[model samples]
Target: MNMSSNMLSGPKDTTRTILVIDDDSNFLNPLKMSLEEEGYNVITAENPKSGWESMEKHEPDILLVDWELPEMKGTQFIKLLRENKDHNARYVIMVTGHSTTDYIVQGLDAGADDYLIKPFAIQELMARIRVGIRIRELEKKIKEEIKKLTVLEMALSVADKIGNPISAAKLHLQLLMEQETVKKSPELVESLTSLFSMLEEALELISKYQKIKEPHSVPAPGGKTMIAPE
Candidate 1:
């Protein structure tokens, strides 16, 4: 069943986005309606060239494309997308009338993740999309966890490198505090004690930072989502 194009009014999705690249309105329009009805954020392009433009604009999590296009075939488009340096870990699925084993091999070898033949069942298509969404979410979560781990590793390294020196300095200050010569000068002893207290605070702060394994959310340079420290 086709759905109304008017998007549902609600809080914006913090979920997956899909970009569909196909020149055929008969195919593209209905596919757009079906996916959107299923609550996906769908963006469409008429051809492969404009599809690249949309890719640059959205960096969608999932890409749905038709095989036969005007300027470039689906194979060429997938190859180009894989080569992009700033590319997302997008799931690319080719929807084509070509159903031969040879065509499927060609698409997959060129970096298309999955393929669907024309007149495909909408239910099956949704199933494939759900699989792609699951993979995307898992990868994103793993990446975030890795970033947090890396930050903690760095913090630990910094603490290890600086810790010995602070410990040694504190010991020397304590020795000075105990000396009769040093204890005779009240002002000098007080200064030494203050410095000793600061070193203790530094060690405490490092202990607290080391204990934090949870990821810290910070605004990405310009991206919409938050990024954990690396």
Candidate 2:
């Protein structure tokens, strides 16, 4: 592979990271400068090896790779990169001289999100980068929402796990407080019985949640509804 190690870099910051893989110094150096000026942390690699490492290390949200590379082609790199679950969501745009229909299809089939031809204007590239930024932000937002939903579901599950028992104990206590016999009974005996019953009730509630039940589904008007076993 006639790969060059002439890497031009920028300081890391809160800006979005972009990995550009191309064996051409003519393209790599200029692209890096343009991207850096636009407030993006750019990682450039002349070979697929260093590109892959930078990808895994930097976790770039956008990729601008040439179709032709040293030993490994752009499609090959993307094929291998997509296999790793961690990089499946990367926004890839091919930058090469090959703009044929077949090559574009092949690149897209290999998991590239978009493509660009060589000798393209810097302004156009900037516009595409902006689009990539928007897309990455949307993906980040969706993931955060999913995380919040998971936390809410967990909280509800926990409440469900403990809600019934606490309520039952409270009702029991109210009954005991209102009853004359229980209120007048030896304070020590009443306290011991009440505490023991509450604990037993809580254990029973927890066990109920632990038991596995067969799910039953019924066809609704528009969808299927699941009924939990009682």
Candidate 3:
């Protein structure tokens, strides 16, 4: 068994990394050079074991795996990666000489994001890579939006629970401030006045928060943006 590994750097502006796992040196060498020429960081591993090690170390954005590997089939390797949460999100493209429907279905079922038959055009492969990148980016954005919505829902729940208490506290403070004993002592009057004002502000803010029908973005410090009630 011939095992080999190589890492080739592409253009500095390109940040996408692609890992190619194939035992055929003749096929792997040119493919690595082609991918690098197309402005992608390329890592080549001749066997599945080395490929898995490289995946753990580099966490490449895309995987180009040959179907027949030395230690395990490409589908099995893809399945293994899918089972591990850390690598599951990475896009996988299975390369195989077989074009049978069964093989294609098997690879897809094993968690390959795409399948490329052997002897494919580099242009087609590059196009597939572009589509994969776009889909991955869209998925990431969707996940971020979902997380933001979840946080917003939790915030609304907390605001609901605390709203009545804040209003009650403000009302009680108002009643206490109206008492003769508090009004007689200047120091007590001043302290109670400040406390009442704070409670009033809290109630007002909670009222605004609970009435939020939509979220709007507001500029924050350091050129950042924060979500606010619209």
Candidate 4:
């Protein structure tokens, strides 16, 4: 059955779908029941084909996949899902007997968001689920903020990139006028023009300072040239 897009709204819901893909019925059943008892809708598949079919039919929010399956390797299954555009939204966690760091790295490289070693604590598994949900929410909020900032930055950048100096000057002047209107600072306009002139003088002074060198020699008594002190 196609799970409603609105069904997995959040933690408040009565049931959240989780698809467990493990060839071992003993492990899969217990894990599914544990999550179901915690108010999640659980589905189990023994192979990648069934798992993919379940994912397409139910649109599960989370997929718990075993590292070893009879039909295909766990990493390969995950890679296939990741390469499919439609499956990109599903959050997959790998369950594996391979507990070494090398295996974990391989799972991540294959695009698993997280992994659980075989014989995981039920409580810890649930906690991981909560963390994943919270992270997804935070990620969504950050992406939205980034998008807004990108739009604003692009606008400012385009204004700065405009080639016409007159257009640039007009933009700056208009910005100053807007600021003055907001603050009611009529004198700011004159102050800014004066400040610009002062800034030009300051820049010239800096250039002159850079060009300055110690006098070649100091005049000594009897018109003798004395070398400058080192």
Candidate 5:
């Protein structure tokens, strides 16, 4: 796909909040406007201090950072952000004139998730930003699903361990052995006494989990509420 098309064609219900950190208003202004036009929420910071503050406040979905700044370079900024555990989820794309592999590696090591060289095409930048955002979204979804699976697996394991019918059988067997020692009739005392207690206890434990039977869910009134065609 072409650059702009690829950048703009993600699922529409979700969009990233982008932070553009560059002192060059000429670059920052246009990029911000374009990103906003494409349905992203764009926030801009003109200096390093302001950028850090914006990062803290907005906790942006993605960061577009200039490689060189008057006070602090982009690599250093990214390093600081990475070291802070709270900002670990922030995705960064370095904006720089340097296009070397070494520079790219430095950016990545400093926790830049992506990179875009300065004077780069707006379409290309947007495409990279789209990629960063999509990766983060997918990662989040995967983590959530894993959490749910872990919980379900734990529940099933507990059920398996505690729900065995052998527990009830063991209790009955112990009671029957005691009755036998006393020379009691197996049919009259052993069977009746042991089975009754086991069944009663099992039923009580089972009742704790079974859903309370509610009245049947009735459909809404008004003849099922038909809708007219548009």
Candidate 6:
């Protein structure tokens, strides 16, 4: 198996990377050039072994895999890629000479996002690639939105747990400050006033979290989410 890469020379539409795995050099080289011309970073691997290595190294967003590889069948290669968590999220398009319905079903069942019969038009292939790119982008965006919502849910839960106790404490402190004994000692009164102020600030922070319509957060140390202040 051989590996080659075509790095974009100048500014391009996007830095989306594509990996092509096919043992036929004649087919692989032209496909690499066509993809590069379409403003994609293209990596070519002549067999599944080199393809897997390239996948590990580059983590390309889209993959163009031939149905038959030197080391293993294309469907088997796709299965292996799908089983690995790191590479499973990629958009895989299986390219093969097989046009039978069963073959297409097998490829899709093996985790291919799309399939193209051999001798396909370059324009059709490009169109398919564009669709794959859009799908990948949408999936990424949805995952980020879910993460944000999860963080917001956690924040609201924390606020709910702490809000009641803080409110009760403030109420008791207010009642105690109104008593004759508490009013008589000026130093103690000052300390209690400061404590009340601190409690009020905590309540205000919790209120902010409770009223959050959209939560923005960052990953903090120790695998925690820290909500960004408005």
Can you tell me which runs of candidate 2 are displaced by over 4 Å? 1-14, 181-230
Over 4 Å off, model 6 = 1-12, 216-230
What residue pairs clash in candidate 2, if any at all?
A: none
What TM-score would you give candidate 3 relative to the actual structure? 0.87
TM-score of each: 0.81, 0.71, 0.87, 0.57, 0.67, 0.86
Candidate 1, residue 142: the lDDT equals 97
Ranking by lDDT: 6, 3, 1, 2, 5, 4
- Once superposed on the true structure, which residue ranges of model 3 sit more than 4 Å away at CA? 1-13, 213-227
Off by over 4 Å in 4: 1-15, 143-230
TM-score of 4: 0.57
Question: Per-residue CA lDDT of candidate 5, range 54-154, in tens?
Answer: 98998898998888886988889988888888887788888888899999888888888887776677777767887887898998978766665564455
Write the residue-wise lDDT of candidate 6 on 59-126 in tens digits: 89899999989979999999998899988899999999999999999999999999999887776777
Candidate lDDT scores, in order, read: 0.81, 0.75, 0.83, 0.71, 0.72, 0.88
Deviation of model 2 at 88, angstroms: 1.8
Q: Per-residue CA lDDT of candidate 2, range 1-230, in tens?
A: 21221332333234788899999998788778877766778999999999999998999978998889999889999998889898878888888888789998998898888888777777667678778878988998888666655644554477576877676776776666677776576885578576867767775655554452432334556675433223
Give the worst 10-residue stretch by lDDT in candidate 2: 1-10
Instruction: Provide the lDDT at 15 for model 3.
Output: 88
- Predict model 1's lDDT versus the native: 0.81
lDDT, candidate 3, 60-150, per-residue tens: 8889999999979999999999999888999999988979999999999999999999777776777788888888889998887776677
> How would you encode candidate 1's per-residue C-alpha lDDT over 1-230 as one tens digit per residue?
32443443433344668999999998888888777777778999988888999988988888998889989898899988888867736799998999899999999898988998887777777778877877888998998788767866787788888988988988988888999999899999889889999999987876666666675766667674442333
lDDT of 4 by residue, 116-207 (tens): 88666666677677776667678767776666456445544443444345445545755665673734765776776665565455444434
Model 5: CA > 4 A from native: 1-14, 164-166, 169-230
- 27, model 3: CA deviation in Å? 1.2
